[model samples]
Target chain A: MNDVLDVALRLVAVFVCFLVLPLVVGQTEHKVMAHMQGRLGPMYAGGFHGWAQLVADGVKFAQKEDVVPENADRRIFQLAPAVALLPYLLVLLAIPIGPSEGAVGQVVDAGVFFVLAVMGVGVLGSLMAGWASANKFSLLGGLRTAAQLLAYELPMLLAAASVAMAAGTVSLPGILNAFAWWWVPWQIVGALVFFTAGLAELQRPPFDMPVADSEIIFGAYTEYTGLRFALFLLAEYAGIVVLCGLTTVLFLGGWHGPFGGDGLGWVWTLLKTAVLAFVVIWLRVSYPRLREDQLQKLAWTTLVPLALAQIALTGIVKVAIQ
Target chain B: MREPTVVAADAADYFQTYSVVGVLAVVGVLFVAVAFSANRLLRPVVPTPEKLLTYECGVDPVGEGWAHTQVRYYVYAFLYVIFAVDSIFLFPWATVFAAPGYGATTLVEMFVFLGFLAVGLLYAYKKGVLAWT
Candidate 1:
């Protein structure tokens, strides 16, 4: 049937995006970070500026010994990477890539809540990896992750709730349809809070104390090796793509361009997401990692309050306009 | 007869949407499994005692792996629980807040709810539970 074919094609596209976007982001990070530090990165791997560096890296990882620590709970340690990697793939299914109904992989009515809930499941991956590793550093890293999640999760949720409030709908495409140019400045505070909290949730730089390589020896992933470690690395990059894409949808007017139509909408969406992804990498190059205390203080004292104010402002303006 | 059929169709549609996510999850797991199995075939696995030992900067790992972690983290977990429950109410309130006549009332009502949560956060702050030390 046509319906079945349509579903199959969409899944294939989502799966392909899930595979490709992360590698692109990863490669960007390698070159961008290298250039920022005054070096050329991976110029020889694929002949043309090392275009295939990540592919080569993947090949190399496949041949490395899959080292599982003897003291680890082998099953959970092995399972952790898949757990971390799958949520982003699932989240990608609900993201609207264009204005039309066909743009999304699967149109869930409550897409916002679905994405948030699914993304939250990724925290467990790190926790499992940390606890099952049976290493002191791994356990500390896992505990740090739990604490970090507790601090950042609320602000993220609150910031998201502000956007949902403004749009008066929880669907991703519905939010896009409701988006007006003015919502940019109006929702700017919530956007910043959401992006920051999301970065912390993904354990990205500055907020990456959970896996602070200098301090924790890569935290929950300390014992991971070979393809298993590579999977976790892939999950981190995939997470960057999802977060940037979601920020684009929720705040920056997904699929909306200066001259608007359903045509070329996907292009605008991808372009905005790529720009946001650049900002994420640029941020990594710019700031020193925040100390644990400072990270928590910023989330609680600054982001949470700012998110609350943004929500109040949104409510007042909505009522006033009515 | 017509009503039951329509309801069944609606239920099927709901499941159909989620089934895509289900398939994607399965595919994700399979992607990793395939890569891993490929590695298993290609990689040399000559494990030694030293290689399997818990890595601690090339030194012998000391003490038990399950070292006593600071109990301070428990407090954050507790706070997360309280706030998470509170935020769940905000979603429905958000929908109602933008409705034609419900705007002002929902705004006031939601603020009261947030005010309570803010008080809870303030109490924790006053008690130094927010302090990392």
Candidate 2:
């Protein structure tokens, strides 16, 4: 009975966090990006920097007519968004938001591996959306997503392997407890590679060829409308949150305070994740979109090679120190 | 260091973690379902023939909806399979590398393995398989 209650409570926690965090961060991303681009975004929605802007957008999306393309595959088209969003929430389960102790999500021995594999599944959702649409643009977009995501996944895993090597465990909290300040310096190259490949994997700008608005007219999502479109948007924002969370745990030492003691350690985790989230938004605003060829070249030629070298470097350092 | 209040004491406890994951997955699907269903309830569904037509920049879509895609896509998939196999060996090698007895020998062996893959990558590059144009 106690175990059932425990699992229930954790489920509710995951639900609330999964739904709310993305909405909040996504709204903040709009305001931040607007400011960066020299405009006032969402000023009239709810006043005070448009706190209710995201809610307004939600209601607007809900009220809009749901349009299905006449030629599209109805079943796969409808299923794609849920597939995209659900795996990300599953990732949150293994992520230790607070500490290794009470008030955390599930702890698996293969946490990092699980996160990496599940995140890779998100590409399938895009592929389905693109293929099911039956539009040439969607097909092209889907193909590009598959190529770009699969290529980048290699580098991301390599970088994560370096951290796993350094920490000697694939679990999130285990990696956290493995180091103090030195982990960052030791895995800095791995962190950079991970962050870069993560941005590409998430299809953010500078690596967002899959949905290049100018080229493909929003790509796989071109034919989607109403709540279906909203689901895709939600998935993208949720992905940003998950990537930020993973970066925080893997690179920044999950939930550890700088002063060497735990004081509402989840607060520290949130702060680090917020900073990373801001950086993600900042990169979106600052960089121009890469062409498809450039995106593939960057992933395969540059980042993968860099990640391989970083792993070799990590191995040498570990052997010498021990 | 303070002990973590919740620890997996046995195999039973460890397996319980998967149940939590199962619960979360259900919740996620339910969340999407509710959002979609709510939209269906509150929104007016007055779809016209024009609205349901495929979007093609205000121009009528020409040719079949399904078009031929570039062959480069398949090439990328093939290359990913090679690297995927290579990285599979890498993850376990990383974990085992840091163990006390397994040091320099493992390192050299893994590098030799990587060296062979590197040669494959080099061949691909030389063959222009990685090129976009």
Candidate 3:
């Protein structure tokens, strides 16, 4: 009984965090970023810093009519938005948000495993979204998104696995707790591999071959607009937050306080996660996305071989440390 | 150097953990309800046909929105799937190979696994599928 209810509540949280928070953040981020670039941001939407912009945007999207192309597959067309949104939402289930501190443990399952399994399934939805989209652009975009996911997931999994090995458990904070002693000083390579792989998985700059606006024309998101587009944007932001959170947990001693005590341990989780998230956003703002061939080569040739080596090294490290 | 909560927290060990997802879902419902209610009460309504047209690339008229795509892309995807699974086996075997005690067993197992990867690669090679111009 509790299991069912827990699932329901998690789903609801997924909607709120992944869906709602971003709507709020998007406006602030837009303003902050624009100011950084020496330009005006959305000032008229609400009072200070356009705080009410997302809410206003939400109302606009909700009141706006949902459009369907006359020739598009109606059933599939309708299903695509929800399908694209679900895997990302499923990601929230395993995504540890709070601190590597104990509080996050209460909210998640064996979070690392849960994250990999659920997050990996997101690609399936991307594949389905493309196949269902009758539009050629949308189709190509979807397929590319799926392919990109495949290319990145391999290395990301290896990196994540290495962390799991060091931690000796798949528990979110367990990975952090292992970091309690030098916080993965023994597994620096593993952390590096995971960071690179994670960037690709999140489809951020230099790895965003899936949605190269200059080339494939917004890729899988070629068809989305208004609230649906907003939903995808929200998922990406929340996913980034979760990605950084997981990384901080796995490598940065998570919620382990400065000297291995506890007080506002959750603050460390958020701060570290936020710092990593800032790096991602900074990278996005500062760099151009990776080219398709370059992206594929990094994944298949470089990262795959590197990840395999790391896996081997993990075994070697395990044998030696014992 | 002693635990603060360890002695006191033991009393709560047998207590049930709160439903994480349930708590989150309730939060989501409340958020949506508030947002929707606010929108209904606050936002002014202004509806007209001009506000509802399919806004294209700054163009008014165009033919129907359907186009044909090449079948080659789908073919490539199919090949990717077959190769991807075949590629996954190599790493596991590689990992198993490193441990000292399982040498001969690992070798035998890897060969058996390699047989499958070989078959797939061979099929792709012979069919001229791997060659991308």
Candidate 4:
């Protein structure tokens, strides 16, 4: 009974956090991007700094008509967003949100691989969404996303593999416990490769050709509307949170704050994640999206080789330490 | 100085970790279902024929929507398969590398393995598989 209650409570907390995250992340992105572009952002919705803009947007999204194209594969169209969004939520399970040892959802043995593998499945959603829409542009967008994701996933895995090599374990907390302050300096190249590959995997700016609105008319999401569209948006923000969390856990030394002891671990985790999230948003504001071919070329040639090299370097250093 | 806690020692104990994953998967699916159902209850469904048509910048879409995609995408998948094999080796290598007595010999062997993979990539590069048109 106690185990059931504990699991239920954890689920509730996870659900609540996932629910509230999109509103906060979306609003922050809007305000930050507005400031970067020197424009007023959301000053009206909730009076103070337009904090309730996302809430208003949520209400609006809910109330809009759910439109399905006549030619679309209706079954696949409805299922695509759910499939895409499902992985993000599952990816959360393998990750530790705070610094405490008990902060993780479960102490899975192959925790790192679990998280990355689940996250990789999200591309199926995009691919299905684009293909089912039955629009040329949507098909193009889906194809681009499929190819782009396939390319980037390799480097991302290699980068994570290097970290796994360094930490001597693939579990999240095990990785955390193995770390001191020096892990960053020792594996800075892995850190950079992971972050860069993560950015592309998340399909954020400079790698967002999957849904380049200018060329592909929102790509796979061209036909998605109302609640379905909201699900996709929610998934993207949830993805940002997951990527940032993974970055924190793997690279930044999860939950280890400079001043306080372990009590404030979640706070440090949150702070680091927020900074990474902000950097994700900042990159969105600053860089123009890469062309699809350019994006693929990057993953295949540059990141793949760099990540492989980092793994080799890590292996050498580990042997040298013995 | 603190000893790391072992998550599990046996198969039964390890399965407990997967139960948590199952719980998470349930919660995720439930969340989406309830939210969409709620929106369905609140939102109006006034679909017009025009709105139901494929969007094409205010113009009616001509011909069938499905079109031919670039062949370059196939090549990308081919490369992915190569790296997928490469990554499979990495996981085991990582586990074995930390074991006692598995020292420079193992490291050098892995590099030689990677050297072969690099040569494959170089071959692809020379063949212009990496080129973008």
Candidate 5:
């Protein structure tokens, strides 16, 4: 039937986006970091500024030996990559790329809650990898992950709740429809808190104590090799895409182009997301990793209070406007 | 008759939406499985004892892998539980706060709730539980 075909096509589109966007972001990171550091990155991989660098990397990963440590819990060790990677794909499904109904993969009623809850589930993947690997560093990494989750998750939730409160909706599309220009400056503090907490949740640099390579030897992924290791890397990039996309929708006025037209809304959404993704990578290049104490301190003493204030601000403003 | 049919259609659409999510998850797992199996076929797995042993920066690993880690951040976990439950209340309040006539009342009520949460966080902060070191 036409309905079945339509659903299949949408799933395929989402699947392709899931596969492609992460690689694009990964490639951007390689090139951007290289350029920032005055290195040539991968000029030779695909012959044209390494367009096929990640493709080559994929091929290389496929050809590399898959090694499960002798002491690892074999099943969970192998299962962790899928666990890490799948949640982003689910989160992507609920995200609205434009104002139209067809722009989203699935129209969940509680889309904001769905995305946040699903994203929180992804930390378990690293925790599982860390615990099951049976390496000392891996265990330490797992513990750091749990600690990081504890520190950052509350502010992230509170910040997101502020947006939902400001918009007066829990649905992603509904939020987009309700977005006004003043909401940007009005919710700017919440936006920043949400983005910062989101970066910490994704365990991106500066908040990447869980996987501090110098200290913990890649942390929970110390034992992962070849394609399995590559999948975790992909998950990190996919996470970047999701976080940027969510920030775009919730705070940056999803699909609200500066030119004032809805027809090219998806383009505006993608553009804003790309710009934010660049900032994510730029932050990585600009800052060093935070120490454990500093990480927890910023989340609790800084982001948490700031997010609470943003919520109270939103409440007062909403009441005043009414 | 039409009302019941409309509700049934709405229910069907909801399930269909979630079923797509389920399918996407399965496809994701399958994507990994397929790539892994392909790697298994292509890669030369000549695992030696040295390779199979856990990596510890080119030296032999010391102590048990499951060593006694300090539960220094256990308090964070406890804090996480309290705040996570508090956040659950905030979500519904967020939706309710914007409704007409409920704005001022909901704003005052939620602040009281947040005031309590702030007090708890303040207590933990003062007690030094929020400090990592």
Candidate 6:
């Protein structure tokens, strides 16, 4: 009874946080982007720079349309968004949200691998969404996403391995506990590789060519509209948050604030994820998406090699420290 | 700069701990329920022929939404997965290789693992998966 109740509570929290996140942390990115572009952001929607903009967007998407193509698979079309969104929800179950004092979060043994494996499975949604749309553009989008995800997943995992070796555990908390010092200095290479891989994983700008808005009208998501489409978008943003959360936990030390002490652990975790998320959005607004061929070259030639070297360095660090 | 509490807890035990906390589950269910319900009540609905048209690069459908895509796309994805998984497994093995007493056994296990990984690479190469043309 307690276990079920506990699971329910955790899931509910994830949903709530996910809902408000765009309004909170995401607002920072939007405001920053707006200031950069010389425009006022979101002031009309909820007053005070559109605080309720995301809510308004969600409400609008629901009643817009839920079209099913004449020849497309009905079941798959309906199922696609759900599939795409499910992994992100599941991914939340294993991440540590706050410090030990605040919440008993960060559930799971081998949190690092567990989070990545589940997150990687998000490709299924892309594949299904693209195929079920019965649109070539959507199919191309799905194809592109699957390839992009698979290409970068390796380097991301390998980069995490460098941290894993230093920390000597795959558990999120374990990785946090094992931090001899800040992971940024010695682990900068792995950190950079991981951040780049994360862009490809989230299909963010520069790497977001798969969903190129102008070229494909949102690509795999073109066929979707209304609430279902909104769900997919929410899931995408949620996945980014989860990715940043995982990245922070794995390398920055889960909930342990910088300059020592875990008292304000939750603050550090939130702020760290927010900053990373901002940087991600910043890059999106500033850079152009890579061509498909260029994207592949980045994964195979650049990121993979960098990840391998970082992993090698990790081995040396482990031996030297001991 | 700040670092998280980098302490080692039993991997399995940590999971047991998060389950005891009642945060994430709460947020997930409440928001999903609200998202769907709010749409049901608040949004207006009036469908039209124009709205129902299949999207074609933001224009009216050209010929059909469903068109044949290149088989090469699928092949590339498959090859990418094989390489990704190989490296994924290999990295963990490498990390564990340096753990004091486990070197010899880890090495043997790794070789066996590498053997499987090698076979897949060879198959893909033989099938010309890496070739763009």
Best by DockQ: 5
- Candidate 5 residue lDDT tens string, A1-322: 9988887888888889999999999999999999999998988888899989999999999899899998899999999998999899999989888878898898988888989999988989999999999899999998898889888889989989998998788999999998988889999999999999999988998899999989989899999989999999999999999999999999999899779598899999999999999999999999999999899889989999999999889889888887
> Comparing 3 and 5 by TM-score, which wins?
5
Residue A59, candidate 6: C-alpha displacement in angstroms: 2.3
List the candidate 6 regions with Cα displacement exceeding 4 Å: A1-9, A97-106, B1-50, B58-63, B91-95, B103-133
Q: Which residue ranges in model 3 land beyond 4 Å of their true spot?
A: A1-16, A19-21, A95-102, A105-110, B1-132
Model 4, span A1-322: residue lDDT tens: 9988877777677777777775678889999999999998889988999999888888999999899899999999999999989898887767786666467666778888888888989989999999999899999889888888888888888888888888788888888888888778877878887888888877789889988988988999999988899889888999998898898999998788787788888888888989998999999998988888789888778988888898898888888887
TM-score of chain A of each: 0.99, 0.97, 0.86, 0.97, 0.99, 0.94
lDDT of 2 by residue, A261-286 (tens): 57678888899999999999999999
For DockQ, candidate 4 versus 6, the one ahead is: 4
Instruction: Give the per-residue lDDT digits (tens) of candidate 5, residues B5-95.
Output: 8999989978887888898888888888898899889998798988889887879988768888787887888888988998978887788
- List lDDT for all candidates, in order: 0.90, 0.84, 0.60, 0.85, 0.90, 0.71
Name the fnat for model 5.
Answer: 0.82
Candidates 2 and 6: which is better by TM-score? 2
Q: Which segments of model 1 are wrong by more than 4 Å?
A: B1-9
Question: What does candidate 6's lDDT look like per residue over A150-222, in tens digits?
Answer: 7788789878877876777776766776665546678888888898998898888889977987777677887
Which ranges of candidate 2 are over 4 A from the true structure? B1-10
Q: After superposition, how far is residue A54 of candidate 4 from its true place, in Å?
A: 0.8
> DockQ for each candidate?
0.77, 0.67, 0.13, 0.71, 0.79, 0.27
Candidates 5 and 6 compared by TM-score, better number: 5
Candidate 3 per-residue lDDT, tens place, A121-151, comes to 6556555555554555556666667667766
Measured over all alpha carbons after superposition, the RMSD of each candidate to the real structure, in angstroms, is 1.7, 3.3, 7.2, 2.9, 1.6, 5.8
